[model samples]
Target: MNRNKLILLTAVLLLLAGGGWFLHDSGFFQAVRSLEALRAYIAGFAPYSHLLFFLVQFLSVVFAPIPSNIVAAAGGVLFGTLPGFLITFTAVASASLVTFSLARVLGREFAGRIVSKKLSEKYQGVLRTKAPVFLTLAFLFPFFPDDILCILAGLTSLSFRSFALIVLLARPWGLLFASALGGSTLGLSPWVMVPIALVGLALFLLGMKYGNQVEETVLRRLKERRSGDTE
Candidate 1:
C-alpha cells in the first residue's frame, strides 16, 4: 500500500480497537440480554445516549456480538420507527463498508485468519461467480453469517460503489421490519406480527435449502458467458 493508504489503515485499526474496548468496558454485550435494561442503560448516558447507541450498533456489526435486529429493536423502543431505522441503517451500512474495505486492502489472506478454512473456501467459491448479488442475499436474510461475509467480500473484485449500494439497499429491509416490531407507535399486534414473522421464517428456511443451488446456477451462467466471449 502507498503511504496515504497505510496511514488510513492504521487509523481504522485504531478506531476498531477503541470501539472494541468501549464495548467491553461499557457492558453493552451483557445488557443486550434485556431490551429494557439496554434502553435504561443508554438512558443513563443522557445527552450522549443516541450517539452511544449508534456506536454500539456499529461495533456489533464488526464484532458480531448481539444481532443487528436486536439493536434495531432497541432503537425502536427508544426513538421510534423512522429515527431508529435511520440510525441502525446508517450505522450498519457504515460498519459493513469499513469491514469490506479493510478486507480489500488487507487481502484474502487476512480474511482467512478471521474465518474457518471451510467457510473461507465456501465464500471464495461464491465470489468466483458474483460478489454483489451474494452479498445482497447474505445481508437480506437473517440466517446468513453476514459479518463474516462482509469481510470476505473485500477479497473480491467488487467496486466500492456497487458494494455500498448493495449494503444500503439490501440490508435495511430486515432491520426496518425488526425496528418496526419494537417501535412503540408502530409495533404491530401479535395477530399482524405473527404472519410477517412466519413469512420471514419461511424465507430463511428456503434460503438454507436452496442457497447452494442458486450459487451453482450463477456460476454456471458465468462460465457460459465466458465461453461465449471466447468464441
Candidate 2:
C-alpha cells in the first residue's frame, strides 16, 4: 500500500479496535443479543432513542459482526415498523455508502488486507464488469455478505451514483421484512410461524451450502456476456 492508503488503513484499524472495545465495555454487544435488552438500552436514550438506534445500526454495518439485522428488529420493536424500517434503512444505506467510498479511496490492496485474500480474489470480477444485476441480487439476498460486498462494489467501475441507486433499490426489502417481523404486524399463529421458521432455516442452510457456487456462476455469466459485447 502507498502512504495514503497506509495511513487510512491504520486509522480504520484504530477506529475499529477502539470502537469495538468501547462497545464491549459498554455491554452494547451483549444488550443487542436480546431484543428486549436492546430495546431497553435504546429507550434509555429517551428523546434521542431514534438517533441512538440509528447510530448503532450505522456503526454495526461499518464495524461488522455486530448483527445489523438484530438492530433493525430492535428498531421495529421500539419505534414501530414504518419508523423503524425508515431509520434502519437510512442508517444502513448511509453506512454502505461510507464503506464503498472508503474501499474506493483505499484501493484493492487495502481491501485485500481487510477482507480475506481468497474472498477478495473470488469477487474481483466485480471490478472488471458492469454487473449491477449481480450486485442487486447479492444485496437482496441474505445468502451473501452484504456489508463486505458493499466494499467490494467500491472497487468496481461503478460510479457512486449507480451504486447508491442499487443500494437504495435492492437493500430495503430485507430490512423492511426484518422490521415487520419485530413489529409483530405479521400476526401469524404458532402453527404458521413454526412452518415458516422451519422453511427459513432450511433456506438459510441451503444458501450457506451453495452461495459460493451461485456467486461464481453469476460472475462467470456476466463476464462471458461482457466479453461477447466487447467482441
TM-score of predicted model 2? 0.81
- TM-scores of the candidates are 0.77, 0.81
**Tens digits of lDDT, candidate 1, 1-231:** 577666866777678788878877888778888777787877778798789879888887777756888888888888898888899988998988988988888775456556678878766766655677677777876656788888888888888898899988899898998787668435667788788768757876886898778656655665667567569
Considering every candidate listed, which one attains the maximal lDDT?
2
Cα deviation at 135, candidate 2, in Å, is 1.1
Give candidate 1 misplaced runs (Cα > 4 Å). Answer: 1-11, 185-231
lDDT of 2 at 95: 89
Residue 189 of model 1 has an lDDT of 79
Residues 1-231, candidate 2: write the lDDT tens digits: 688778888898788778778778778988977878988988988999988888888888766677787788788878888899999999999989988998899887656766787777777675557548877988887766788888888888889999999999999998897787676534557786677567656876987899878877877788888889889
**What TM-score does candidate 1 get on C-alpha atoms?**
0.77
Query: What are the lDDT figures for the candidates, one per model?
Result: 0.78, 0.81
- Report residue 230 deviation for candidate 2 (angstroms): 5.5
